[model samples]
Target: MYYDIIVLGVVVSILFSELTRLSPAGLVVPGYFVLSLHSPMRAAYTLLIAFLALGAEKLLGRVMILYGRRSFAALILLSFLIDGAIQASGIWAGNPGMIGCLVAGILARELERQGIVRSLGALGVVTGVLSLLLLAMGHPVFGTQGVWR
Candidate 1:
């Protein structure tokens, strides 16, 4: 019963964030929620997400540094892109938000390693503002109203 409630809560949070047009961070929050509801599954899921994000960050960082490109922006964008891909896969499997926390965590790790601590803090603020703006832009708050729906 507890696990069921936990799972439902995670699902609801994910769906709510989606419906309310919250920022991607909100969507990512459910990953932790879901992971907290289990042990083995959580560990496995986290491992996969971490690997994906870390691998991408390393590769992209090297590329950006080598080519003298926008490293910070690229890292942030790649983090989100990789997260979105993971979420998409989860949704296809009927477990949307299963890796939400993992995505956020992975991004956080990458950001810290790249010495973007200030920007990461800024991202939290930006995410909140964006969520509010999205809400004002006629986005719902807890239903099937977003593009994903």
Candidate 2:
């Protein structure tokens, strides 16, 4: 199931991005997110962590010049730091590992480019479509016995 979801998610994300010319939160992000579907709160927590990284980048951007690779590195570093901080705070114990290795950073990048509303809207739409496709594939995570099995 995990294998299927990740591969399919990448494929879906690429297709969506090509069609819309948007990142869809990066190619692998939707896959990571879809895996969290069984636990909605975990998904929300992941989003919170991503938003935190994005916010941190905004703050950091004000102090120094952050663009291109610098901006990307800062976002990834921040995501890891914030994820660690959250875990250390004992809030959730496990931090869901950043949705994907670069999910938060890439997502932050997109949000900055397109604004939160448009970026998230694109992400939500892509993920929702991916979820529906997974459902049709008979993935147990979606409570389906396997319509296409």
Candidate 3:
């Protein structure tokens, strides 16, 4: 059931990309975001990490040659570093606070490729559609805490 979300999201993401030619904050991001929806705080934290990664990359780009795979790698590394720092801070000890940890990196990649506004807009639309589809399929997207039903 958990994997179903990813599979569905991938399918929807592919279709969305083909139709709009937008990355939707990376191909696999919506599902991971959807999974993190049970806790808005976790989702917000992940997004904050992604935004930080984007800013960090922008600053680093001035100092280094970052493009293609190099940029992707740098953003990912930054995301991991930020996530680790959040974990070590113990501010969110009750929860890992980095749900969809790698998602921030992936999202940051798209945010770097597309302008943040466009990328975020597409992500929101795709995620909303996916959530609705999940609810229609009896996934119980709301009022279940972390459970499917």
Candidate 4:
């Protein structure tokens, strides 16, 4: 069921980007978002981390040359560090999983390329559509129950 959701998300994201000429918060982000929908806090935490990473990137950009691969690497590293700090501080109660950092990095990159409002708007739209589809398909969108059994 998780795999199914991810595959579906990728397909939908690709189609959406083709139709709208914009990415839905990067290629794999929607899948992670949909998977974490059962735990809204986790999703929110991921977004927060992404925003933090974006802020860090913006701040660092003033002093350092961040472009192309350099920016990507910096964002990923910053997300990893932030996730590590959150975990170490026992801030979040549960293990939101590693997808958070990856998703944050992607989302931050998207946010940097496309304005925050647009990227987040697209992400929200994609996530909402995926959630509706999951619900319609009898999948649990807000609990531990899996689509299969």
Q: Which is the leading candidate under TM-score?
A: 3
User: Global lDDT of each model?
Assistant: 0.45, 0.79, 0.86, 0.85
Which structure is stronger by TM-score: 3 or 4?
3
Model 2, position 122, has a per-residue lDDT of 83
List, residue by residue over 14-122, the lDDT tens digit for candidate 1.
5544564443233344333332433435434543554455567677666556222354345445556765786676643533332443354534454444334433443
Candidate 4 deviant stretches above 4 angstroms: 91-98, 144-149
Provide the TM-score for each candidate, comma-separated.
0.34, 0.85, 0.91, 0.88
* Clashing residue pairs in candidate 2 (N, C-alpha, C atoms within 3 angstroms): 138-146
- What is candidate 2's lDDT per residue for 21-88, written digit by digit as tens? 88787778888777777666666877887789989998999999999899889988998899888888
TM-score of 3: 0.91
Please state every model's RMSD to the true fold in angstroms.
Answer: 12.2, 3.3, 1.8, 2.2
Which residue runs does candidate 2 get wrong by more than 4 Å?
91-97, 143-149
Residues 22-107, candidate 4: write the lDDT tens digits. 88998789888888766777788888888999898889999999999999999999999888888999877885645544788989
Runs in model 3 deviating more than 4 A are 91-96, 147-149
Q: Give the TM-score (vs. native) of candidate 2.
A: 0.85
- Over the full model, what C-alpha lDDT does candidate 1 score relative to the true structure? 0.45
Q: What ranking emerges by lDDT with the best candidate at the front?
A: 3, 4, 2, 1
Worst lDDT run of 10 residues, candidate 1, spans 140-149
lDDT of 1 at 125: 46
Q: lDDT tens string, model 3, 1-149?
A: 88989999999999999999988998789988888777787788888999999999999999999999999999999999988877788766665466565889999999889989989999999999999998888776655565334
lDDT score for candidate 3 against the true structure: 0.86
